[model samples]
Target: MNSDTPQLKSFRSFEARQDGDRQTSRSESYLRTGRESSVISATIQADSTGRDMSIDLDVSADATHLKRFVVSVDFGTTFSSISFLILPRNTPPDSLDPHILYHHIQTIDHFPEEPCLGLAESRKEVPTEIWYPKEEYLEDSIMGDGTGSDDSPEGDMPFHLQNEDEENTYWGYEVYSCQRIDTDPNQNRRMGGFKLLFDESELTAQIRLDLEPTLDMMKKKKIIKDREDVISHYLKHLFSHAKEELSEKHEYTNDCPLGFVLCVPPIWTPKACRIMQTNMVRAIQESGYGSFGNCIDNLFIVSEPEAAAAYVIESTTTVLPKEAFMLLDAGGGTVDAITYTVNQTCPLRLEAEGVEAGGALCGSSYLNKAFQEHLSARLKDEDYLERNGISIRSIVDTEVVKFENNIKRKIDIIRPTSVFEFVEIQDLRADPRKNFGRNRLRLTHNDLRGIFLPVLEKVSGLMERQLELAKMRRINVTKVILIGGFANSPSLRSFLKRKLASIKSYQDEDIPLWARRRFLVPSSEPSTRETGRDASAVQVMDFDVMNRSILMTSLLTGESFPIASLWMAGST
Candidate 1:
């Protein structure tokens, strides 16, 4: 003990309890006026989440010394997002609130190679992907579309994935743009959807089945030792980038205690959380974030959907007093549906929540998969029609990407298109008799409907299930706020509206989803600043327990399930 401080006595009594989804604590210290003796009794009531999180503390006036420098991560299938906030370290807890915390949250939008891609503004998240390069492609690794393998005149390759660089492991934006020459590791190796594998153990075997050839090549070519090697290595890179961004902005060298908020997928099991936590800790330790224990206090875990819901409800003007809203987190590879009813307005307390899930992996990526399959099957016989199969393959690749970026999101409710012509492939080949092509490309609206139906069916089912749960709980879904990357698709939005129109509880409202302001123009701010229903931490520390900091990480991720520009009264 410091000489000026009073010596503490033994423990008197400690009490803990739960109240819905809120955590509150108060402590009273009894100190004798004589020599030095003190007794502290604390009653901490935290949200009784069945997980290992069980602490809420009261920081004394003297303990509020250092500023809370916060950094958060969302490791997703399609993209990974990071954001940070630096509150005045010396201030006490009473001075800080949710509103003050909202403005300071800044997303790490300026990635290494993002500027040159010609984006009008900064991107909220980097693609969650990794690639290992072959020694043979020294001529260059072109990023954007080129005429052919030998015909690259001008291109914008990712800055982090240069052929001249010594590093072979490329990650994030590095892998986002780079092309995979062949399946063989002798040519190159690329991997995504690794985050999904964290949910299941045998996912390793399943992934091996899909990437058996490429993975086997990576093993033989000595790029990666095994499957875990790829995961751990990829995670290390992600942590390193986050460390760099945090360090540069705040001059934070891990000198002070770091509060980390790791968001868990909604459908993740307890076993899966443990596995992901271990890998995250290891990745942080290896990324030079100091010794993991020294920097990180507790791995604040949160459900992605809930965290996102909290962020939207708090930051925006959209308020639902004693009303339920369906929070649909439609990401790249997964869609999670949950309903939360606001019980109070002052502090925004949610009473009843219904979490009904869709398929394990159901999201917009299925549509991409469907479109790719359509192209492959439709173009396979073209090898006999013309010797330009290689060119045709290149065109299909470009067209598929174009569809994912543009066409997929354009399927709206108000205006609908009948035929979509190929921008690249203008050929006289098969499917001219039907409306599958115009320049040999007349893909009718029905053709697209056939491709979009499967994914739409699954997503619609998720919404319906959530609605049913809400009805069962007697909570009418007054509004539906859709987040996540996939929400940008108007087709999915339109389909869900039609599917749920007949539901009695919903009453066939306009039900506008929060899916605007991403591509055409971004939000006035950067990220969404999501709220955490599962674990919304405040990062209040006592600096006791031998300098252990108590971290409350409300790692609200607005970008991961991006919500900006609210709509009400079922307005579009």
Candidate 2:
């Protein structure tokens, strides 16, 4: 909120002024602040000579807007999107040309309704959530675990628990969720807590850049803090950053007419929906976007699957004639299936089903369990477990970290170095004396593969069950769409493909090419060949399915019955 932010202050134009007015003119402060002011009002432009030209100014002023304005923001758990609305340049509101406005409005080039899916990957949106515990509660939580904390900076966030070993500490989000790190140490190093912030001053610039999406500070507790409050705080920061970016890019003074569409998984319960909505609205307000009494209008909420569906439909040239097809959405969070009957006489009719299992929690949890079981089965007591500080448990923990951080990279490394086997371990206090044993452990790459494979199989089974239910209802299961963050994994896609192959009558070649490519098949993919499989295993992957469904829903959800007015073929 103040110009003292590092990024803002870094600019020569942001220097502090003697007769300072922070609110009235930021440009003055910028010129007088942190850095040397000699370069103030210098505009860098290119000339035909390919040399840079600079223009100096003695005074700076606020920008003015001449037309209607608006902005739309899509805040997701892992990522977010923003768009703008520009009113006609010269026409008055009453004389506005609808067609002209439509023409000027930009439609996303690919998958207009949904964010782009990276090549051969699925899942849209980014996460912007953070987690932290109340200071009052931290002591009790840490004490209940074991060992007392030392005042050393290294152990600043250390945990002391009653039952747990002193050395068995964890940190970061995993610390809270997995009960590993010392509570104090974990809280201190947590990325999303105090450390997550840039100087409120630096935020304006940081937000302008695209930050990688991750739950860096997330804790696994059921209720670490009010989710809404945290989400609102984060959003406020993001919006402020976005505004600064816009200001730097264009000149505008009046409030913009913004529209936003947020996508949620079909399985979001009423409680979750309410929480998300309230948090988002509050976040928008806290971010200063709604401060001037203007807010985003035409806000829309579409299901994850439905958004993907919209992306699919928008990309195609073919139109449906009121027939029902099932949409199976497999993403990071959960698997959802829906039936939509596309008709000419009326809007589409929709019915849906979803389950708790999603790729993020379920698939990842399964992988963890498998790794743990593999370590337990292979190592026994007194088998070099105590000497040299090497043990099966430590290896398991290290492997889990590798699994979470760079499992794919490890897989690539292991594939070339060892006999196709998996390896896993978690030894934070690893001993240098056990170098030889560590080399031997590296040879067990098959162990890692074994752990991940079973979990992939479970995901396949879930899809199969969903397909079966759709078949029972006699609904035409069209494309089985795979989406969400988890859909990006080659392992998951390969396993799902195998499942489809196993279902009766499914030919390997008959599987949709888009499915084989593991990409969200554009709606444009030809639907020429119909699989004769058990009707349950055929799934499609696409980005637009979810949004398209929402668009249709928005259009038709509350409309009055279409009246069949009296008509005669030769009435004219």
Candidate 3:
């Protein structure tokens, strides 16, 4: 089996100076550049000392010709996207042609005499869509072959749709959207990030309790027996459809090969991760990407935030000398925080921090809850006339599916109120029952802002905590990078700038110098606050830090990872 360990490399190696003192507040000043043999011997001698020791995993490619590509997939619960990067190959290997004394050479094929140019391509967007097809059987009265009869058990199922080429297609986003939702709307109100009744505590157990009401509602409609049964049936249907599509789509039915990297949420627990991975593997196999009836080698899992990080990191030219900086990924599913550091002598170091709270979900959730409250209130004000008279059963029983007066209207009974009205009825609406229950509610921008404020606060607190931790460890942060769909919000950026500035402004004497040194006060001020005086000189910038620091640190260290590794190990 091939080794799957990812490449790790750093740019610098540290050596103790003759003047180095243990009592000094700082770690040994890193070795000055251009001093090779002298520093290497000193480092080796220092390593022999009886003390705490550590190793770095700096990885680098050899001088040999090679290519690299980075792929980023922005996958959300409801939607997904993909991006890719193709790296430039450094140098082509020397090749020998048939030694002919005659120098004259002419080819009928107008192949360019110049070497074939290799191009590295990077894609920035891949949609996250998976589709499956329903199976079909022939009519029982069929006079010919056994495509199955209408009276046969399999005949009644929906047949999978054939692709344009008459091959079945799966693994795209279109397929996922067309499938029937398995859970009851009342039970698992999850559309992307909004889980109506998700409580962190009692994770698995109460999940069903929260789901039962919706399941019951669906059961009434004869969608499925219970919530469990509904999901199972839905999965079975999807799996069957995917398999059929896969079988029909490709010419080589035995070879279903797909290359993919999945992005999961940062806060996902091991158990949750396992469940999700299992489901994904099953889905992939059913979709025909599995080898030997299983999904293994073809699948790779990276956190959604990490995928964004990889995407953004590769886009930058600035590399970090210290190789340490806070990474904030504000994406659709969640906001993830990570600290990444790379030094000449050490392997890439990464640590994940924070939770998933960034995106439109929180905003949308607040809106949905507000709307529900409005509907309930309207029902009460009308002497429960609307709620009592409108029969969900009748709609399901008759399968009316009417837009004006059927299920859609019933679902829409409760409307969300605007911020203007929300503010006007703030006190009145404080009574949860009367406010959110009524219909005809519209949430204004202010309401949306108010709902998002708390979430922003949580994110701010997390960053502050991370800074404090780094200060304790004497790690200097050079830049703070943010990416993802939510990061595109101007309001969010402004809010973060203010909060970060406030944190940086802390002048407490007890604060460590490392923290102060790392703080780069943002130049932009909050639009809401008027300031006559420019506060600090710290220049704040947002861009690709990895590429920026690379050259600088590479110069600082005499050689790159591959060369240094051989030299470092060969010395002993």
Candidate 4:
């Protein structure tokens, strides 16, 4: 709990005085600084609350001796992850190396099944999904069981849980697997997209229709008592898994000093941010962190875009002095864009107020929706299959969606002949119609483009708006950095490159609008070459938020003290 750390005394000693007298003393101190007169005037105006501006630079100079751990949680809309750095006793903070310093907690390691479709390798992140079995089904299973107790036999529990309640309450991978196998949707209630409900305006009619069943189930079962409870329940499971992993890996004790930083969308209003923070604090407290003695006081909130900027500025080698750049964080639920001007390169002083900031609800999930709609339309158009009483919606959801998610990553926009064959349905096998020839779905370049065009257009528009603002401010934005889960989309990357290239070459009556901006994306593989002390040793992780969280954790813990000072000054 650094919040209770002692404040620095003023350089000049003074006797106890009234509030008015203290304001006069602070104004006098400001006037006596002998710096720029405008700066002094601005300082006085900024401190209207009469709070002290002094800071003790050496407050954490001796903190290196303390045994502590820094942890960051990215509670994302589609998937959530946690990354952490451990500072052992007597380890000097300055000597820490980022290349091997951070570790992803791998939250879904012990899941009953793999989480997402086509994920062959183990992943550090977990699906932000939960499933609640119907009360009738639970009761039936309990009555049918030979053992009356809630406890299951060792090694017989699904997901290896100790109690039967956990078996009925599934999360992450189990939700997906259960939904696919059990056609009776009422048997298990699976819930996703609850994260988007934080902003009420973003809750569309379609989204509401999709969430109604789960919401009703949650209410009836008391799985979620309120909107905040939805987030708290998920977070409690996430943190509990993280605590177990950390305790085993580092042998962490109850007394170990631990700090948690949570990342939120930059475009969230102050009200939304406060709500999220309150729920997060409540979640941590209810997760049994309170027994560890004031651990909750160490919680910090950082904007997602700000954290991404910190990582790009510190980890990249090509970022130039005074160079401006645009960051596009296209996540599952939203896309946020921010433009930054680097004021200093050595200690990294970035413009606090961005040249422009914008966001939209259009994200990668919308592509899936569009694809689902397209398939539904095709099924509707072809009457040959409907005559046989085949349900098109079931075929699309259970079969087509899985194939789409897998191949969407490998789609080549330039290849017009690239075909995606639909998984054969036995009902369609007997119907030999021209439209259903070979039981294959032919995806032309235009068809493929159509699937992604709606989302890509929204993203491109956001970037264009940010670029226009930068131009209006006369900022020579040098680079465009892409991050988040949607950044992994090849179609998105290609679309942006083509769109930006056109804008760069577009002659506005012989004036190039955006000729100098360079597009940069994170490489999948880590670099092996060392850049020495002048450059950061941290290699970018596959997960963008994890990398950003690592940098944010370091910044918050005074490892990069000067950057923190600059951040505070900029906030003022």
Top candidate, metric TM-score: 4
lDDT of 4 by residue, 438-526 (tens): 56554446766787788889998998888787777666666677767676677777778777775541123111122111111111112
* lDDT tens digits by residue: candidate 2, 96-213: 2111122122111111122223343222222333333423222434321111111111121222212232123222222324323322223322323221122122322343232212
CA lDDT scores, all candidates in order: 0.50, 0.34, 0.30, 0.50
- What ordering of candidates by TM-score runs from best to worst? 4, 1, 2, 3
Of 1 and 3, the candidate ranking higher by TM-score: 1
Better of 2 and 3 by TM-score: 2
Q: Write the per-residue lDDT of candidate 1 for residues 465-531, one digit (tens) a residue.
A: 7777767766667767776767767777777777656665645455545543221001111112223
Query: What would the TM-scores of all predictions be?
Result: 0.65, 0.48, 0.42, 0.66
For model 2, what is the C-alpha lDDT against the true structure?
0.34
Q: Where does candidate 3 have its weakest 10-residue lDDT segment?
A: 558-567
**Sequence-dependent TM-score of model 1:** 0.65
**Candidate 3 wrong stretches, greater than 4 Å:** 1-209, 212-257, 266-274, 288-294, 304-307, 331-334, 344-446, 505-572
- List candidate 1 segments past 4 Å from native: 1-68, 112-119, 134-166, 180-188, 201-226, 246-257, 290-298, 345-348, 352-360, 384-398, 409-414, 418-421, 426-444, 506-572
